[model samples]
Target: MTLWNRLLLGLILLSSCWLGLAVTPSPVATKPNVIIIMADDLDSRQLSCYGGKNLKTTHIDALANEGLKFNHIYASEAMCVPTRASLFTGLYPVRHGSFQNHKPVYDTLKSVGHYLADLGYRVGLTGKDHSTKPKTVFPFEIVTGFEPNCVAPTDDYQLNDVRKFITRTNQPYCLFVMSINPHTPWTVGDTTEFDADKLILPANWIDTPVTRRQFVKYLAEVRRLDEQVGEITRLLKETGQDKNTIVVFLGEQGAQFPGAKWNLWDVGQKSSMVVKWPGTVKARTETDALVQYEDITPTLVDIAGGKPIAGLDGKSFLPVLLGKSSTARPYAYGIHNNIPEGNPYPIRSIRDTRYKLILNLTPDEEYYNRFMMNAKQKDRNSVWFSWIDQAPNDPNAKRITDRVVKRPAIEFYDTQKDPWELTNLATDPTHQNRIRQYRQKLETWMKQQGDAGAALDIVYAKKKE
Candidate 1:
């Protein structure tokens, strides 16, 4: 062979190597993945990790032990769809036009899917899909499994679709796993594990044989939910994605009890939120920072190395997560506009760490919701009837029944001292000054959110340009 021929062959090999290097993808292109697991109708206090005495939640407690557990996080609305919408869009229900349950947000609104997708992440949803309508607004790649009732009496909840989505994708992803557990018809899980006679009831709960029976069944479902959480986290760890992924578990809303589900009180709005980010967030930490469902989207966006978007009701709680900020917000607001589902009993509330003031806009009318009223009236267990039956005989039982149905114009409570919110301090002369200050705060907030007050009852219409 000639020397010139050998030189030419060598040059060809060097050029091929150069071309391969030029075409290779950069390591920076692989961003961190995010996984959000949301549970339905479970409150923070229902979990043993959050000081729950009634039941033990071993799996969720492990996550809390390994991540940051937030003490004062809340849902923007007490119902499902509205709170879910707020979490995705980083806007309050009224601002997002989904203040009512089963209502859709305005057509133009974009969600976390859009924001994360912009940064080259594949966004997908599994389990419950109760977000706003037009479908395009959320735009998540749908994954299936865990669609049955909370108390369906079957352990058929599968995560195959979600697992396949993760394994198939080489790119980073944002996966939302919604678990429809502890919602209603409480029939799933081992009811026998929780002895009705031995179960400890909440301070506000009326102690009756039927009430105890139903409460134990509800506790059983909560235990089942904790098992599901364990399964999801175990999968992430086994797949070697747990380290790079930020796993968030949220108690979507309060339990479906009489005073908790549809109201704007602490039990209704407070949620259990735990976040695990291997490197960025310090483990085994707890924060008392005030955060709402509206803040979730922005915080996730910031965690994914994205810039903050403008005109959002929620400010990112990234600082709180990173141990840089101790306080997230001074106050968290709540609104409940009951229509279509029940009577037009509009309520607005504002709460700081210690104080809370609730304004019942339609105080002249009785508060009514068909589902809740039916639960009391049509309950086969006669739990609610027992409360009403003993109302006249027992003053405490009477107070509980009256508080469930009746409403005054204004109600105030120092939640620090009155967590159950039994006593109304709005009429107390000693709290008159405090009441006036909170009233002004509530009104200012209403105006800022463009709330139409009682006018919300007369069918909400979009304002003209």
Candidate 2:
């Protein structure tokens, strides 16, 4: 047969298959490569695209420019393990049995690894494995080299390991490039880049030498993280995988500063999420849709052309990603179980775009985190001590410091009016009805999840490997 005739026959066959004259499947690839680059101890509000004026995150801003940014995404639990556990499995910490810090996910539970693997994806994770163990629930090929702290200089050599994985893999890949940036012992990034005297501190932060010094280091780490992200994106482009990959950059939980990481307030629970899926997701778009870490697994499952597992706590936010839906959930929930790292102070919270309700289960016990509480340690910064010393003269500092150490049983804040949550509205007569509704909703959810609240905190023991 002639070459032209053979080409014409192939076209005819393809058209016939599409028209149902034949039974051949479509030739186009349906599975997409997925990459989630998560930055540890990073805050969404500190990003340039998120109204952050102090630091210029050029690379992260570039991702936001090329993808969709989610404004109200949250971590199910504020700390690393719980939030990461929830992210891996489409279940809250209570249901997954990994709510406590440094605890493993229940042996019988299934995670994203099992779900995506079923659809023929080669899943791998690199840098910071804070999620639960037993390795059965979350099985991943570990990529090497970007495994150190997040403040380390962004080196092109570190990405060589990830580059090999993306270029060598033919089957769909789900790569998690988790960076431990801006975490405590923040001494790896460029300190000279940020001027401690000129940086803008958080409204709730006490203005002291120690506070400024630590924050300056934290911001520098964040900048380093941004450069690392740029390198990954560039790798995808060079490898010709950018078009077929869905790249998601997430600010896992929030920074480790007071009222952020270990608490259940907005700063602690909220995370910054930006997703780029060339043709599938719209670029340069923003949404205020409420999404939680729990929703991530189901969303990935759905996007990977697989059935979402039944009985999962999270539903897929695919519609929101596609710009077909303006909202994902009516409310986002948060939980904080302080044990193994601090005093046993359990907290549960719920928010619906505006108001936030926080229930401190062990309000009578003064809040304490041994690591943060110790300011005189050689490696530790003295922000905590400075705050305590300046409390008498600075009213705002005193108020913030007191709130961090002490708590009431019921706390409510109008997040729309006070984004920082400086004022408690639980006692306001006008907000009584809304407060009651949220409180009841949270209690009902706790009951459904079989969460014993304060009892869970009391019984939490460090898991044995």
Candidate 3:
């Protein structure tokens, strides 16, 4: 223990301490840029990335190749406002109480964007924010994330504006890019300079002359949307942020067709979901695991290491994204409540991997005939509405519309056999056992989630008085 020996030992201790400090992971390493590109009323079967033949989505296809694509992703509610609200709040439409299109989403609940903003991330939204009620008066500085230099109603140019925002932002950011291109008013020609003839019709859709013409217009809009996606991806690559940012592309709901958006069928609830997280998620992977729009908020929060609020219906699938084996929720719940000028007061559904059970709260006649007049009125302004109405004029339309509108009180479908869900097997004795099991499960879930519908009888009684 001489003076020289003591000095050497002290130096060794100091070096060890310094090495430990140098190797510690920084907070920045845990944070990643999050960008969600949400499409309005998009169907999974309509994208090239999802085996859609009618449309060419090169950019989105590239994203799917580079990341994981979900085969069975759904919106909590099959409508714009409610689905968006569920995505933001991680709650069901009944819980959030923003069940209708024009209904406002309350700001008191925490949103993924708000959480990121609180955690020192620059948050912005572009295109469409269909949250009926956005909590913050001025939640985002850049509305639709479009730059001042960009022209309006042009998908390509608007996406360029999004890229500009990403470059201009000084901090880590969460950008919600909402697209309205594939929505309604299917453009016949180049409303925004994209090819229309290259578009193909969906295999399931009828190939009649009228159907073909209608589908061509719809395909043109889908192409426009794909172009916008391409531009956004190009922007990310140009900025050198493609590898660092986690890009998620999803549809708010299904295609805006008859018995689609407002119904509880696969065509209404199922949507396209693609996620690209470089270095973490494996490329060219596809997952058939069931995921809901409500799960998006929790997953984002988990990735960002932000605090999750209590009573959220969604469970985060970060492990699934990171190429790890994990257990997701066993089932997803769906509600088809109010649609403008359309109704069947309240309908609830439960979908597992194989089967879907729908409970019609209103009788068939009351739900169909009562709403026919209102639907006809809505057709006055909406091309989709007008087209759907023309179904009665054509025998085929009559058949399709009849199956859609004359839904039974309780309907069951084997999702594996019937992805479009054109058939109802509720009355089939062979499937009676499966139907009962799902019905009971739905009731139990409703009770567990404190669903207002579970107490609908009481609520209606009080309302009558």
* Candidate 1 per-residue C-alpha lDDT over 1-465 given as tens digits, one digit per residue, 9 for 90 to 100: 799999997887789898884434567645788889888899678799999988889989988888999988888779898999998899988889888876678878999989889878899888777783567789888887767344455646787877898888689999888887887777788887888888878887789888888898788888888999999999998899898988899998888777888888888988889998888788899998999999998987887788998888998999998899999998889889887658888888888778889989988888877776666457644666777778888999988888878889899998888988988888889989988988898899889999988887655555443
How far out, in Å, is residue 353 in model 2? 0.8
Give the best candidate by TM-score. 2
lDDT of 3 by residue, 383-424 (tens): 334446577677665666566656578888888888767678
TM-score of each: 0.90, 0.92, 0.82
List of clashing residue pairs for candidate 2:
150-180, 150-181
For each predicted model, how many residue pairs clash, with residues at least 3 apart or on different chains?
Answer: 0, 2, 5
The Cα RMSD of model 3 versus the native structure comes to 6.2
Give per-residue lDDT, candidate 3, residue 349. 93
Candidate numbers, best TM-score first, in rank order: 2, 1, 3
Range of the 10 consecutive residues with the lowest summed lDDT in candidate 1: 148-157
Question: lDDT for each of the candidates?
Answer: 0.84, 0.86, 0.71
Please give the lDDT score for candidate 2.
Answer: 0.86
Candidate 2 Cα errors over 4 Å, as ranges: 1-26, 148-157, 375-379, 459-464
* Candidate 3 local lDDT, residue 94: 71
- Model 2: per-residue lDDT, tens digit, 1-465? 999999998999899878889656689765899999998988778899899988888888888898999999999898888888888998999999878777778889889888999999988888887673678878888788676434344422387788888888588999998888867667667889988999888887889998898888889888888988898999999998989999999998888887788888888888899999999788899999999999999999999888869999999999999989999999998888887778789999999888899999888889987667765572465778889889999888789999999999999998889999988988999999998889889999999999988888865555566
Model 3 score (lDDT): 0.71
